[model samples]
Target: MSTTVVEVENLSFRYDKRLKENILSNISMTVDQGEWLAVIGPNGSGKSTLAQLLVGLIEADSGKIRIKNTVMDDTSKWKVRRHIGIVFQNPENQFIGTTVQDDVAFSLENLNMPYDEMKFRVDQALDLVGMSSLRHHDPSQLSGGQKQRVAIAGILALKPSILVLDEALVMLDPKSRRELLTVLQNLKRKENISILSITHDMNEAALADRIILLESGKVKNCGTSEQLFVAEPDLEPPFPELLRRELLKRNRNIPNEYMTEEEMVNWLCKSRLTV
Candidate 1:
C-alpha cells in the first residue's frame, strides 16, 4: 500500500490550433510520496508540456488526474495548484516581483496565508535556498543563478508537497548547480517532499529514484537508471558509462545505488583496504 500522490491516466493534449497533432498522448504515470522522479527527453518532446499539466497550467484533453484522491478539474485547478509548485527552466520567466523577497511573497499572497505566517515562511524559504542575504536585492539585478534561487524560494515559501523542476539547474554554473542540488536534497530529507524533474541532463536524471524517458508525446522508457544502464546497450546517447565499471565489474550489482558525487567518493574510500 504505497501512498500515491500523483496519478495520471490516459492523458492526451494539444494546442487549440494543432488539435490534429497532440503534444502528449496516453501519458500515464504515478509518483509516490517522498520519491524523486525524473522525466527526460529531447527538445520539444512534451517534457515541459507534461510539467504544465501536472500543475494545471495546461489542461489535459482527455483522461484524468488525481491528486491525493481528489480529481483535477477547472473548478479545482486553483485549489489543486497549491499542492504543486513548479520551477521553470528559465528563471526570468518566473519572477513577478520587483525584489527577491517580494517575488517569493507573491505566491503566499495568492495562497491567502496569514501575514505573520507568510513572513516566517518567506524568511525560511529564502534561508533554505541560501538567498536570505539577497532578499532586499532587486530580482533583475541578480545573475542567472541567483534569479533561479529566488524562483525556488518562491515555491519553497508556498510549502507545496510536490516540486516540479523543469530544467531548474540548467542556468547555473557547476558550483551553483551543485549547491542547489544540495539544497533540494536537504529539503527532500527534511520535508519528505516529492520531486518531479523534467530535464535533459542524464547526470541529474541518474539521481532520481525513477527515470521516465519521453519521446514525441509518448513514454519511451521508464525504470531505475541502473536497470537501463545495465540491461540496454542501445539506449540514447550519453548513457551511464560512468557507472559501468562498478556495475559490470565482476559483480552483477553496483556497490552503491546513490547518484551523488559525494556518495561515490565515500564508496571508493570505503572499498580500499587500509592496512
Candidate 2:
C-alpha cells in the first residue's frame, strides 16, 4: 500500500483576519509517497498560498495539515518542515553560495552535521541532479535550469521526503523547462520522493501522476490528466493533447485520451506505417 505522506483537510487561510472571505476555502488534498501531485490554477487561485501552508511557512486559519501522520501546529511546524523541501519560482533568489558545491553544502553545514556526512550528502545530491560536473562552476555563470538544479541539490542534501515546487519552472525557457521536468521525473523514479508542484502550466500538470485543479480557492477537479481534460474540455491542455483534440475534430480515428509528446509521436509513427 502506498503511504500518505501529506494530507490536508478542510484547510482555510487568509492574510487578513478581518477579511470575511478566506483565500483558501475548505481545501483538502493528499499526496502519496513517491507520487507527483500537481495543483494547477490561474493567478490568485491560492496555489502559492497552499504551498506555503504545506511547508508551514504560513499558518492556516482552520483545518489540519498532517505530514507523515503528524499534525501541524506551532510546536510541530518546525519538525513538519524538516520533511519537506521547497523550491520557489526564482532560482537566483535562492542562491547563496558562489559555487554550486558550496551552495549544496550550506544547509548541511548550518545544521552542524558531521563533515564526512555533509560531504557525502552534497556529493550525492549533485550527482542525483546531474550537477556534479558543474559543482566547481560559479552558480552565477550557470544557465537558469542549471541554477535550479543546484537549488534542488541544496534541498536534496537535506534528504527531505517531499519536495514542493512553487511555480519553479515558470521563469525557464521552453527547453530549460523541459529539461528540468525530465530531471524531476528521474528523481521521482530513482529517489521515491513525493512531489507537490503548484503550477499554472497545463504542460507541467499533464506530466504529473495526478492533478488537482484549484479555482477561486476551491478544488474544482482531481484526477489523471486524461480524466481532467475529458471532464473539462474548455480548459487548455498540453500541446500534444491540444493537437490530439484538433485531429479528433477533423474526424481522425485517434484514441480519445491524453498523450504526452513522446506518446503522440509514437502514435503518429504507427499510424503512418499502418496507412
Candidate 3:
C-alpha cells in the first residue's frame, strides 16, 4: 500500500509579473491514497495557486512535487500530468465540447482510447455524476449544478488517481450543491482516489477527513476538521450566524470550535439532560 500519494517539499511560487514576494512559501505536506483533504482558506490565501501547482498546470518558482512516486520537473511534468485532473471553479469555462457527452469523451480521445471502451467509460463517469440523461444536451443549457456534474465527469473519464477541485461547487444553488456533494461522496468511496478540494465552505469542510487552513500564504492549521475547529475558542459553527447563536445560548462560554453537527448536538443534548 502506498502511504504517500502526493508529496510537496519546500514549495513556493509567484506570478510571473509579481517579483520578490512568493504566493506560497516553505510548504510541505503529504497526502495518503484514499484520503480526502479539504483545503480551507479565505480569499487571497493562495489556494487556487496551490491547486494549479499540484497538477502541473503551472510550474513553481522553486520546490518539488511528486504524484504517485513520479517526480515533477519541467520535462517530465507533462508526462506526470496524465495522473492528475483538475475541476476548476467556473463551469462555463470548463465545458469545451458542443455537448456534454463529447466533453466527457474528449480526454479519452486525446489518450487514444479504443472506441468501444471510450463509450463505456463515458457512460460510467456520467452515471457516477448523475448526468447521463443530459449527455446529449449542450453544456451551456444545463444549470450550474448540472454543469459541475459534467465537469466532474470529464475529469473522472480520465480515471486519474488524484482529484483537485477549485471551488467547483460554489456557484450552484443549495439543493444542487447538496446533490453534487452526495455524488462526490459516492465517488470517493468507490474510487479510493485522493481528493483535494479548495473551498471556503466550512459547511462542506465538516465532511472532510482532513482540513488544511491557510492564511496569507502560510499554513494556519493542519489537522482533522475536528482538531482545528476545536483548537480555536470560537470556531465551532461552520454554518452561519444562526447556528453559532444557538450553540452559545446553551453555554454562555462555548469553546472556540467543534467539528460536525453530531458532536455539537451530542454535547448540547447531554448538557440539557444534566440540567
Candidate 4:
C-alpha cells in the first residue's frame, strides 16, 4: 500500500494582496511515498512559488498543506519542514561549507546532533550521492554536478522523507544532468525517498513517475509523461518521444508509444537487425 507523504489542498498564494491574482490558485496535489513527481511548466507559471510553499519557505494565502499527518501552519511549519528537504537552482548559492564533507554535515550540525552520529550520517549521505571520495575537496573546486551532489548529500544527511528540487538540474550540462538523474534514481530505489522536482525541462520531467503540468498558476494536467503528452499534444515531448514521432513520419514500422532513452536505443538496434 502507498502512503501519502505530502498533500496540498486548495492551496492559493499571491506575492501581493493588491494584485487580485493569486500566484497559485486552488492548487491541490499529493505526493505518495517513494514516488518521483515532476512539476513542469513555462516561466511565471508559479512552479517555483509552489516549491517554496511546500517547504514552508513562504506561507500560502489560503488553503492547507499537510506533510504526513501534520498540517502546515505558522505554528507547525517548522515541524513540517523537518520532513522535507529543498534543493534550489544554483548549487553555488547553496554552498556554505569550505569542504564537501562540511557542507554535507552542516544541516546535522545545526540540529545539534552528536559528533559521532553526525559523522556517520555525513559519511552515509556522501556515499549515497557518490561523493564519499570527494569529501575532503573544496566545494568551490568541484564541478557544477559535483556541487549539486553535495547539496543533495547535505539534505540526505537530515534523512528527510520528502525531497523538493526547484530547477536543481537546470545548471548542469547534458552529461552532468544524466549522471545526477542516475544518482537520484538509485536513491529512489535504495532509500525510497519521495521526490518532488519542479523543472521546466521536459526531458527531466519525462523520467519522473508522474508529471504535474502547471499553467498560469493552476495545474493544467497531472498524469504520467505519456498521458500528459496525449492530453496536451502541443506541449513539447521528450527526446525519445520526439524521435519516435519523426520515425513514424517517415513511415517506419515503430510503435507509437513513449520510450526512455535506453528503450529507444534497444528498439533501433532490433529494427536494424531485422531489416
Model 1 misplacement above 4 A: 16-19, 236-240, 243-275
lDDT minimum window of 10 residues, candidate 2: 266-275
* Order by lDDT, highest first: 4, 2, 3, 1
TM, every model: 0.86, 0.96, 0.89, 0.97
Full-model lDDT, candidate 4: 0.92
- Residue pairs in steric clash, candidate 4? none
Q: In candidate 4, how many Å is residue 117 off?
A: 0.7
Better of 3 and 4 by lDDT: 4
Winner by TM-score = 4
By TM-score, the candidates rank as 4, 2, 3, 1
lDDT of 3 by residue, 1-275 (tens): 75788999998988954587778887788888878898877788899999999988888888799998898887888777778789988978877799999999988898899999999999999999988899899999898889999998999998888889999888889999899888888888999888889988887777778889887877888998768776744554375333645656887555455436666666567667342
Instruction: Please identify model 3 stretches exceeding 4 Å from their true place.
Output: 16-18, 234-236, 240-245, 251-259, 262-275
Q: Could you tell me how far off, in angstroms, the CA of residue 166 lies in candidate 1 after the best superposition?
A: 1.2
Mind giving the per-residue lDDT tens digits that candidate 4 earns over 117-196?
Answer: 99999999999999999999999999999999999999999999999999999999999999999999999999999999
Which pairs in model 2 have colliding backbones? none
